[model samples]
Target: MSSSPLASATFWLLLMNTTWPSHVHNTAPTPRGCASRARGSPNSSCPRQRRSATSPDQFVPRKAASYYDLLGVKSDASADEIKNAFFDKSKKLHPDSNPSNPELHSQFVELNEAYRVLSKEPSRKEYDLKIQHSYQGRQAFGSTSGHTVYRSTTTNDNVHYWEQFRHAQSPEATAEERKQKKKRNFRLVIYCVITMVLSVGAHAVFFRKLEEVHNSFMDEKDRAITELYNEAKERARANGFKKQTEILRQKHADFQEKPEF
Candidate 1:
């Protein structure tokens, strides 16, 4: 008694359904431990743990304390006061004195840096300006944002906290100052050139006027001398003619008296 084709196919389907699951179960790989899971795996069902945003292993940069506060001196403290404070602090905080403590050694480095900046006149002024600018910025930001930003008084191991302000006196600022100085010098040169030109022109005009006056005076003097010479010659010629006439008359009278014999 042969079964129909539909019945035979139904029997094979049931057999495969029962046998396939057992074969798959026997051949399946064992589950790995959550600790041994690879990093960045997308299997969210696994009970693997993740680090939080505030994990201690993450690196966060800290702000440094103010130089004046570090040195235990006022912002307006004189050089001698700052020097004396540095010496006093060094006595306690020096790496040699506190060789056992690394924290104190770090503080000593900060102290040296603060003293190096404050001991010099130019560097101290620059640092003061930077501090003042930072203060003003904080005030403005707080007023506008309505948020109080807290500044930390703690020291940072990184020296880049102060190095950031080195950009405040950047080459761009120096170039601008040099440009202003050059502009002033150029204006001074122009003024000097104008003054010299005006003076030379004035001298030329004065000399020309003096030469004209001298020529006119010389012409007048030559005319007066010629007139005087002509008058003297005429008077001398008239006197000579009068004397000749007188001599002729006396000789004629004598001849007339002698001819009567």
Candidate 2:
């Protein structure tokens, strides 16, 4: 019923790691009801919905870069064309070739991710379907006339659609993003505290050892000096040099007056 300290630490570490989200850039098809949600209308079979259902492969994300666009190729471009484009872009944006430039490195990563999805057969088909679905969704908001009078322009409709779509998605996405950011900051603070504690502990041990060594050296030096002084006194007494012995005794008595190591 009680966990050990190691178990508790491991639990927290795993929790921290588990809370981190995957950074994969792959996109999935927008749900079928997105258009109705975008328009704030109860009609599930709105014009966009009908059109999307009819041609789901025509979908494309309005806000995202298409694989064809990223690769600088036509939608109908061949696999070889995509490969060539990737090679050219990779050479230009590779991080090793452009050191200390983070922007270029990011671009290269995106490029590689795009290539990874586009280069595979099954993934390419899935990606194409999602792209078509997005394109059709965007088209769902295109200009429509009632009684030969246009209600809204394409640009205005698109603006309104995106506004509603963003409003719906914003709350949940923002909450998750904020939660992740706070978790990352908390992890960083924990790391800093641990580093500081270890550093202080190491310095304390080092200085304590240094002080001990210094005391031992000073004691040895003082004993050697005392022996030399005794030898000098005896030699002076044996030679009958009382004045020299007195001078040596006076100097030895004032040893603390001189500079110490």
Top candidate by TM-score: 1
Model 2 per-residue lDDT tens digits across residues 1-261: 898999999989998777434443343466776754757465654444355555867775334456677778887788777777877776787667879886674455556666767766798999889777766765686533111212245575445434433321223444686798999999999999999999999999999999999999999999999999999778887767777768778889899688888
Clashing pairs in 1: none
**Which candidate tops lDDT?**
1
User: Which 10 consecutive residues of model 1 have the lowest summed lDDT?
Assistant: 145-154
Candidate 2 has an lDDT of 0.69
Q: State the TM-score for model 2.
A: 0.30
Q: Give the TM-score of candidate 1.
A: 0.33
Residue range 133-192, candidate 1, lDDT tens digits: 777887887745332233324454445345434422323444686798899999999999
Q: Residue 169's C-alpha lDDT in candidate 2?
A: 25
* Cα shift from native, residue 236, model 1 (Å): 56
Task: Give the least accurate 10-residue stretch of model 2, judged by summed lDDT.
Answer: 143-152
